[model samples]
Target: MSTPATSRARGVERIIDIFRQLHAARRPMTMRELIVATGAPRSSIYELVAIFSEAGWLETSGDGSVFFGREMHYFGADYAAHNDLISRAHQSILSLVRKHDETAQLCTLEGNKYTVMLSESSSRPFNISSDIGVKVPIPWTATGRLLLGHLNVNEIRALIPDEDFVLENGTRIAFDDFLRDVQYADAQGYCCTEGLSHTFRLCMAAPIRDRSGVAVAALCFMTSRDTDPKKRELMLDDLIKSAKALSEPYSRL
Candidate 1:
């Protein structure tokens, strides 16, 4: 038997599930599509959609495909405004984009995976796409390595699954090498990698530590693998300085 409170909580979970599916799809979806994707009962889907639509939390297209409503944008905007790290990091990342004309990211660890909570893409013809809102395996990113600097070797080994060592390009990273990278990052306070996630992209990352000096997140930028050596060095210097600037807000946090 379920209480009324329990039933209401489940209803909220269903609503969140629908929102997750829509966010992952990144496009309007019809009723049938939502049903197939969510695997929820048809009646529940209909009722939930109707309620959300009426409340301006969802909207339907002319073709009856459903998407997020203006209210969701308003909610998201409010969240961005009040989030301390995001508000501070957003300005720092934009400055990096203007300075180096490269894609800059604010990355944090979500469990064992990495998330680009915020990103500013470059205007160059051969720019890299920052994997914002995508949960990627830790070994797939330089930022992940730097972010793991906060953890001990034992904690890191326990957290990352063995299968996560396999990259999208079919390369297998040795655990010993990954551990060494983490140790190096912890010592140096930064790290850089080339041809990890994509063959033509290079990444540079620095730590954003909390008041206790644990690296809660990373500040990173991506450059072309073919970038000039001298220019890359200059960009790295600018990035390290910008990373420090971003870290200043930690005391308040």
Candidate 2:
């Protein structure tokens, strides 16, 4: 037994679902695509998109494709500037880049995924590729292990549905082993993973906490395993210092 008001509310929710789909796609979408994606009628798709566009929540291109509008970006940037745990830590990130001469990355845990929000590439001839705006499974990366430290083993396993963690290059870590490594990282105050992606690549990561003392992100550096021992120790020292420095600004936000 549903009232007319309840049915109308359900219809509005469906429209909102469609809007979220467009926003997540991060590109212009056609009405036909929206209809298919939302499973809404063509008329309903046009009606909803028109309403969103009129309110400046969506913008349509000359080709009749639609995307999230400038308003969304403006609002997102505003929220990110204030809410972003990484932007507040920029000074520390910059220091690490300058001190180590290797690329540094700032990664945050967003639900179950690890997203690289900012990174500074090394000035050296060889450095890892820019990882900004990339998402990696939390168990498959050094930074991911640090991010997982915020959660207990059972919580981490619940977040990741797969039984095993796999790298892009066909390397894999069993779930039990991955959990053990995360526990080890928690004990060590940092995480180190070698050859997860490339054969000789090495990565070190430390967690960054917000004002509430919750580990919100991981500051990580990638380099070759063959890096000179003296240089590696110096870099690790800087990384730890930077992590502490970054934690200070986070309290302000």
Candidate 3:
């Protein structure tokens, strides 16, 4: 009962799944492993893998495992080159880290979760850093509050899943408290949280607004929880300034 359009769409979905599986694995996968991971028919997976390999989207190893090819790297490099926001954000985080000697990250909402799009780690031996592209519960991050500041109460409630309210340590955040934090963050133009995601870490975040003044991304720093209060304020002030600079119109850059 599948129409040609539906069939082609399914094929596209399968191709995307193949890449997703490989990325999640972080290594080469054998043909059978790919079939199992994607849940596609063996024959279909074989055909698609063959086509992708020939097109340089995938490459095979001597042991018969397959992984992403050089073409994928080229595509990623091209995207970074052309994306003004990403390119600029990268520079901003690098500068922030160099100045403060702390971990700095560029973050944004991915679906209902917060994700670190780019990160610059501190040179110190002991520092906090998040894995890029890892999806984290929105309620567990200071940037999450800032990112959702533009949303209405009803919209924010509906967007985040109920289970996401629970923290890693089995603590449940009150909805009313979370809403108040979001509003405060919007009004103050910055936010800070201690021991929300990690027991001994402090997070500070500032919004990077688009032309309409809605937060489309965030600039954040993660430091030790025991950092002096005066130091925290200084870093937060610089972070807010940096974020505002990045939020300016692209033509201004």
Candidate 4:
């Protein structure tokens, strides 16, 4: 038995799941598909969909498929405009994109995962396609490893689940090894990992620390694995500079 408040809360949570599934699919979803994806009752799903559709948060296609409405873009744009970090980071990321001709991203930890907050794609023929807002296992990302720099060995251990190390590509990094990466990033103030997530590219990340010196986010750069060692080192240096630029303003906030 659930109260009205709990029922409303459940619906809100379910709505988020609906959007997540839709985004993951990168296309519209039918009501039946949403019901299966969300594991929600059919009636509740229908009602929620109707509410969102009417409010312009969602839109239905002619074939009865639902997708993000134009209004959702408005909300996202409005949010980006207001968030100081996103605005500031976007400028820094674009500079990297222009200079290095490689993808630049700002990522943050979310639970046991990391989500790309913003990205500027490279103008080169090949680029890393990191979809913004997609959450991936923390252990699978170089940024994820370094983002844990703020936490201690025990806290990091508690925060990351054992299963996360078994990447989608079937590689299982030992906990001790992963812990060492965190410790190294913490001590060295930056990190670069190649082929841990995407086999074709390398990622370099540095902490964007807050006033309290806690890392709230990461600024990262992606480059081809074929890059010469000297150029890779230079790109990594630029990434560290960009991260510092973003972190400095936040240090006052």
Top lDDT hit: 3
In candidate 3, where is summed lDDT lowest over 10 consecutive residues? 244-253
Q: If scored against the real structure, what TM-score would every candidate get?
A: 0.92, 0.76, 0.91, 0.94
lDDT of 3 by residue, 1-253 (tens): 9999999999999999999899878889999899999999999899998999999999999988999998998998888777888899999999999888999999989899999988999999999978887888999999999989889999999999999999999999999999999999999999899999999999999999999999989999999999988888889999999999999876322
Clashing pairs in 4: none
> lDDT of all the models against the reference?
0.86, 0.75, 0.91, 0.86
Error of 3 at 19 (Å): 1.9
lDDT at 87 for candidate 4?
85
Model 2: worst 10 consecutive residues (lDDT sum): 244-253
Which residue ranges in model 2 land beyond 4 Å of their true spot?
Answer: 1-24, 98-102, 120-135, 197-202, 210-214, 222-232, 249-253
For model 1 the local lDDT of residue 117 reads 84
Query: What is the Cα-based TM-score of model 3?
Result: 0.91
Instruction: Please give the clash total of every predicted structure, in order.
Output: 0, 0, 0, 0
Question: How well does model 2 score by local distance difference test?
Answer: 0.75
Off by over 4 Å in 3: 251-253
| TM-score leader | 4
Q: Tell me the tens digit of each residue's lDDT in model 2 across 1-253.
A: 9999997897798778776677567578888888888887888778878887998888999999988877877886776677646565666777788877888887776667777777888898888743555556777678777667667767887898583377777767888888888878877878878877667888888877667666667788888888888888888777777776677654333
Can you write out model 4's per-residue Cα lDDT over 113-161, one digit (the tens) per residue?
8889898888777787688888888988888877787777789889888
For every candidate in turn, the CA RMSD to the true structure comes to: 1.9, 3.7, 2.3, 1.8
Ranking by lDDT: 3, 1, 4, 2
* Model 3: how far residue 157 lies from native, Å: 0.9
